[model samples]
Target: MRDVSTLVSKTDELTYKVPVGLKRVPWIETLLLSSEPSIRSIEDTVKLEKAFHDASLFAVKEGYRRLAALNVPAVRPGDFLAETLRDDRTMAKVKAKLADEAARIKAVEDRKRVQAEKKFAKKGANKQQKKKFQQTPEDDDLKNLKTLEQRKDGGYSGKAPKSKAPKSKAPQSKGGRGPGGPKGGKGTKRSDGGKGGVRKSLFKKTSGGGKSSRGKASGRRFKAFFLA
Candidate 1:
């Protein structure tokens, strides 16, 4: 993704900038080489320098585009062609600094790419080894079957001893005492039996019934009649 984006950016830069810059170069060169008396003046010299600078920038942009097309290491604007414009000291310094930065960035990206590839390779190798280790139980059964057939063809009367799988112990009841404990043996009651040997009710009704005033009076009158 990164490579593709960089290529796109370089392509756009070349498309827009290269043609105009190249056209100005020959025109600028002719003016600089002119024998006209006005060409040597300070004003014309400055204009000529500006023209040369622009043309150099264009050349550098083209170089970057070409490098990208050829799959060469990329160059930034800061690392543009310095030797082309001998009079521009600023471009030279900017180019040097950008070049160093670009180199550092490239080195870091290359290291990251290498590390990612190695990690994927290691993962693939581990998957292959795990697959090799995972032999099906059926393979062992097939070997045993072949051995049995060979024995029968040889007229051997004795049978091979069969290998038995170890039996798993049944899960113990959660509410009952385990194994040889007194409560677990024979007819002994389980832990659910209370200390008094009486079974507790699963639910009990609460007292404090709401007796109405009429019901209370009727009960007292009934008691009084019974006493008489």
Candidate 2:
């Protein structure tokens, strides 16, 4: 095995040579001339990004100084003269994806709101129905009182009341020989005589052979009876 002490002594004795008067090279120029090295790890990618940022800062400072010395304009003539890293078509696709994501989020929110409203609305409807059908204590008491009062007054029976039979009136009698008198009374004789008399009167009044005279006689008799 190698001795640890000897290895340590050799490392301590080693010396690095430093070059003098070497040409200075800027990171911006080096990056512009060649493609960046492929990153192998996360740390390497972060270091590359930091280097690119530093190069951009250096370019901005150098470009301003160089353009001022050359008496040239530094700002572009138009905003569109500046180029973007991503093309217009790629940017358009990114915007479309963003819009789809926003729409989907909005639709989900609307659906949740509608469901919550429906849930609350059903509870409200059920509450209203319960209130409508529920009987109050005051109303129940009033109804009971009314029923008791009716029973006390003998006004209400459990079943419908039976209808009473109409009373039959006795035939009126003016005297002992009136309409309701003896069966063989003078009133019967008078009635039998009046029928023949009424027929004879109608025939005698209609002897002119026109219906107008007969109708007039009947009308007059009815009018006299009504007045009496």
Candidate 3:
């Protein structure tokens, strides 16, 4: 088999002399023939692609260099007359496909942007709601403080009436006796069996005497009864 490097050198030598339309076919045929045996896997396909890329770069550089040496512009001017390989109808179809692809990509980007905005907006709204809820208690406390200050300064007149403390019942002994002792009976004995019993009897005796003289008379009777 012919060496790939030798074929490359020969193709390069012929590049300057060959017509533009015919210059590319020889190099393409040469690459295909050189790699035919090894082009069995994806890796070989990638290598072929790399070779084509390098060849294209080399062709572009050589073409520009040649044009520069000949005092010719490398890029065709807008007004320059030339025939294209594709007909106008084919070019129109290609342009339409390219425009459709561009529109599809832009639509995808716009959808993604709208979705992102909605997601972030929802998060922001949730944050604001949380902040409002968190501040509610503090706001109520401030209002209560302001009302209290207004009442203290006599600026507020709609104050609630003070609640009265409930009246407490007098404490009684466990035996159901009052502070004075047991209720009336004929010299009733007290549970303590102390001077409290005598004092209770004396109170009962004097309680019925409305006049001071009657009370004194009852007191003398009590003294005599006790002595007896």
Which candidate number would show the highest lDDT if scored against the true structure? 3
| Per-residue lDDT over 1-228 for candidate 3, one digit per residue giving the tens place of the 0 to 100 score | 879999999998876454476735543233232222333455453355446557656666766665687676668568543464556786567567667767999999999999999999999999999988888777999998999889888899795569899998644434223345455323334566543344444444445556457767677657745642
| lDDT per residue (tens digit) for residues 1-228 in model 2 | 979999988887763323357455433333233223534555553355446657666766776676677676778447552475657786677667667767999999999999999999999999999997897999889988888789789897775457798998644323224334563233323434442222233334455666566667778667544432
Task: Provide the TM-score for each candidate, comma-separated.
Answer: 0.26, 0.32, 0.36
Ordered from best to worst lDDT, the candidate numbers read 3, 2, 1
Candidate 1 displacement at residue 37 in angstroms: 34
Q: Provide the global lDDT of candidate 1 against the true structure.
A: 0.57
User: Model 1 off-target regions past 4 Å?
Assistant: 1-89, 141-228
Residue pairs of candidate 3 with colliding backbone atoms: none
lDDT of 3: 0.62
Error in Å for residue 131 of model 2: 3.2
After the best TM-score superposition of candidate 1, give how far the Cα of residue 205 lies from its true spot, in angstroms. Answer: 99
**lDDT score at residue 150, model 2, on the 0-100 scale:** 91
RMSD of each: 26.3, 16.9, 16.0
Q: Each model's number of backbone clashes?
A: 0, 0, 0
| Model 1 C-alpha lDDT per residue in residues 23-125, reported as the tens digit of each score | 5443322223322223344555445655665665666576666567666786456755554446467666656766776799999999999999999999999
Write down the RMSD of candidate 2 (Cα, Å): 16.9
What's the alpha carbon RMSD for model 3?
Answer: 16.0
